[model samples]
Target chain A: MKTIEEINQKIKDGNAVVVTAAEMTRIVRETGAKEAAKEVDVVTTGTFGAMCSSGAFLNFGHSDPPIKMAHTYINGVEAYSGLAAVDAYLGATQPHRDPKIGIKYGGAHLLEDLVRGKEVELVAEAYGTDCYPLQNIHTHFKLEDLNQAIMINPRNSYQNYAAATNSSEETLYTYLGTLLPKMGNVTYSSAGELSPLLNDPYFKTMGLGTRIFLCGAQGYILGEGTQHNTEVERENGVPVGSAGTLMLKGDLKKMDPEYLRGATMPEYGPTLYVGAGVPIPILNEEIAQHTGISDQDIGCRIMDYGVPRRSRPAILETNYHQLRSGSVEIDGTKIQTSPMSSYRKALQVAEELKNWIEKGEFFLTRPVELIPSHGQTVKPLQIKRPSILVKDLKTKAIITATAQDNLSDVARLMVDNNINHLPVIDKEGKLMGIVTSWDIAQAVAKEVQELTHIMTKKVIVAMEDEPVEVIARRIDKYEISGVPIVDRDNLVKGMITAEDLSRLVCSRDDKRGESL
Target chain B: MKAWLNFSPEIVNKAVISNLMKNFDVSFNIMNANITPKGGKMLIEISGEEAQEGINYLENQGVHLTPVKRVVKKDNDKCVDCGACLSLCPVEAITIDEEWKVELDDQKCIGCGFCTSSCPTKAIKLAD
Candidate 1:
């Protein structure tokens, strides 16, 4: 086992440590919110699907939180419209002569066709021939069209009607099982009476599961019988109904089973998860009520606080995968509530979740024991132990320049040791000042010019035991490139440079033979 | 044989201009195109060149120019006595109330993007 001093030295020596997403998540979960917040430099959210249950283990701190909800929109009308447009384009082109040409659709239908080799392709020319006059249409045909095919159009209006009705009813399932139950309590009413033929048992028989949960919050209920609009124009006049209906009715959850099968499971079983959309409104309201601040102000504050914290090194390394995925594990299970699969989405979710947690709508808790995806490997580089403590690298060094110790001697010492700087020590071994090649060059330049130049009379020295980050920050902030490291006893140990700090984080991928 | 007209000035000028336009998007009216007698040879002259001129032109001009610079401006009508710029000014040159709008101390200004990027209405310009 290495001593703490040895470990510190190893870290100082620029040794790379490999950490797994699972291990990071576990640490965060164990540390709780405050500790995790401190441990985490950043948090990310909106890690849809399989990644939802894994984020809480990034770090012990809640530096970044997840925000953003993932939901699927099902739009049959849009699908039909898209199919109609494709058919129209194909009919006009009719590039392929082969009648047996294959036509493909979205992933859901692709999987279905993969199982059943026969698939349907609706042609607009045929529809036009059957429903409208062909002479009025000047059909421009292009050869070798890939999207053309032949199939019976399943224009069963009753099927669409049944689906539309069933969707509205099934929405209660999503609302009750997913959203309402999470919100705690709420009242619900529908203008369309519940079908007597449809009961809990009927739904169960249909594999819809039991609707055991209800919204806990107190809220008003409104329901009205409304005409179904196949097309409705907005103020912009682009027709909003199709897009709206598609978004509200599209079924993504049912289509992603194959993806789910490919998903890597967590160490523990299933757990509850919340979506960003569901929690954000509540969080915003709570924050507004609690702090008496405007929502915009709250948003700006959260964004300002969240981005910087997340940018920290430790937090970034900890929540790499969670930042990739927006969802977090609640209890032990992964619950994906977002549709996004991008890193930016995950970050957005994390920021929103941080705001929500701050507002106290829901408390973040430990969920699972994260297992390491990547095994640990020992780093090879070795770092020399510091002899003196230093607070910052920006300060000027105190050196005692003796008559015997001329510029040549200092230059020789620096060149021989491959060092740029050397702090001159007194007879008692106490640091008096420092010297560098640049200092010698300046002195030489002044001597050559025969100009009276005042050398630096005041000297600044750094304490040796300061954190490397602090030293680096001061060096960068003050535009100083190098500084002397000193101990609590004011003895000069070694010098650090901006180059060293840069090299510490820099890594070259040996396998790829490229720097990352 | 006249050695003075050995090189076609038009071809050279066109080639140089084409090359310059390829690398940079520049907007400038050609102020003058003149021929000067140097060492008994005709030399082409092109002027009124902005920052985005092509490589050959810039090389011939021999002036170091940054293509991108921050934009700064002050609208006196929108000036409120909010002392936000005083503390937020990285160079500590911006004062409140005396001029109302942001005042730049040329010596102190380091041409950093902080003040220009942070300004809500974009009243600061790091002029090229």
Candidate 2:
């Protein structure tokens, strides 16, 4: 077995392409084109590339490449290809290092720097189509190694996209690396612990800095407006290896690098490196029918080698340089200054652009709508009546009452069912008013003080058919703690409150505790 | 050497005397001060001591010395549980509960209203 250094030497020798899955596909296609023209020297890098190349040859009415791609199965489950095989090979070759090890994450470019510096060897690139697979690969490899590891901006892909407006390459590099100078070695159990760590007073007191790695990926997956595939089996089967990587990285970053390196390996494993695949271009005819980009531009960009040589080189060089050494300034203060910085400044600039768009600086472009799950449009929560529904979990009896209910009656209901508020419903089962202890107190005070004379007759009531926002707005407008849901016939249905809104807004899972 | 002794009615007196050899701005003398075998208060007149300092010194020494009387002040009545003054408190004397209730950690609380303005409730105030 060749050592990692040998592999790196082989790559530098131009014996290996070191292409990702996507690039491999393109290579395969090019090879197929060459083969059709009776050229046999062309070879594809990986399996996908070989397949694409073969397909391209068929399209070109030529023979396919002669080479067959190698494949392997990992842990008797996942199909390992390309760099995955290399990762496995390297992992198996290395002597299992001490389980307890400390890891320090620098910028995304840190590993690249290491590789460039010959401190570490790049044996292979794991093939992955998305960040999820890449993260999974990382975890798998880490688990196999059981050594102290550092994840440097594993979420940089998405972070790059999200912060493209405000982030510049330099700003990103500096932001990521500079955080280390300010942070003390800390350890956490899970990714969930990272947010609190960032908010810790010690960070403020000491002017410490922190950056999220895989943990940010977990946050993205768990954040709102996430689109998931409708295929239940696929959705459920998708491994949360990324989440685990995040948790592991969080735990590692919190610890002192040395101590963390020496700490026991987590029972769960390491992640393998997964290479992101390149996107295939749609056929020109198809593109002309669907996309707004001109066919000439697309053809020139993809097919015309001559055109690219003239115009593309400059753009590519500039982009490469920017990717290598861009900087971002905020409020006249230079925040980031590093080479290989993720496009953090781009993200910031995007944000500024979004703000300008909102201010109608020009006709704003709308983001493409995501395909809905199962082709179903999600319906907004609608209020049917003005009443809060409080039900007894055991008895399943709906406790109905109004905001005007007697204090004694309300108290009795609360004591009996062990509930806080009751939904007041009218005779037609329509929502009317919500009665709580506070409401009772206000009503009683008004009665005693004869303040009814000055009270407004307009009782801003919410209809059951209205949206939940109606009730929310009412609560905000009136400064009332709760709102009564009433039906068209003036009958109360249920009551909702600020607490309910908070719970609804903050709930991690959509399913409420109906059983409870 | 013989110790020189002088008598005066005033317990603390300041004298400015110029000598041909040296001149001094002021000098304090303690005369007719109480001296008991059980250790009566020995008034060592300090020319630089402020009036409040003398009173405080006498109080610390367990001497029943009284200075000019002043009006008594009222204690702060409103102490809402807002821990705005906590950070400013040199002693780390205040804490806020999960319910947003403020409480003074007596061991840490120095009774300085460092948190007073921060308190939305205006709960911290100086007392007489």
C-alpha lDDT of residue A29 in model 2: 47
For model 2, the local distance difference test gives 0.27
Give the residue spans of candidate 2 off by over 4 A: A1-15, A20-22, A28-398, A402-420, A426-433, A448-516, B1-128
Candidate 1 regions with alpha-carbon error over 4 angstroms: A1-405, A415-418, A424-433, A448-481, A487-493, A497-516, B1-84, B89-121, B125-128
lDDT of 1 by residue, A1-516 (tens): 222233223334434121112222354346543443333321212211111111110011111122111111111101222322222111111112232321112222222222233333322221232332231211222112223222111110000010000111111122111111221111111100010001110111111110100011111101100221323322211111111100011111122221111111111122111111111111122211211111111110001111112221111111112311222343353322211121222223334444433443333222122111122222334445332224433333343343246666666766766666666665666566666667778878766321112223233444565556666666776676776676767666666777766654353224235633
True-structure lDDT of candidate 1? 0.28
Best by TM-score: 1
Residue A277 CA error for candidate 2 (Å)? 12
In candidate 1 chain B, where is summed lDDT lowest over 10 consecutive residues? Answer: B1-10
Q: Considering summed lDDT, which 10 consecutive residues are worst modelled in model 1 chain A? A: A156-165
lDDT of 2 at A349: 22
User: For candidate 1, what is the DockQ?
Assistant: 0.02
User: Which digits, one per residue and each the tens of the lDDT, describe model 2 over residues A424-475?
Assistant: 5545676544555555567676663322222233455655545455466557
> i-RMS values of the candidates, in order?
21.5, 22.3
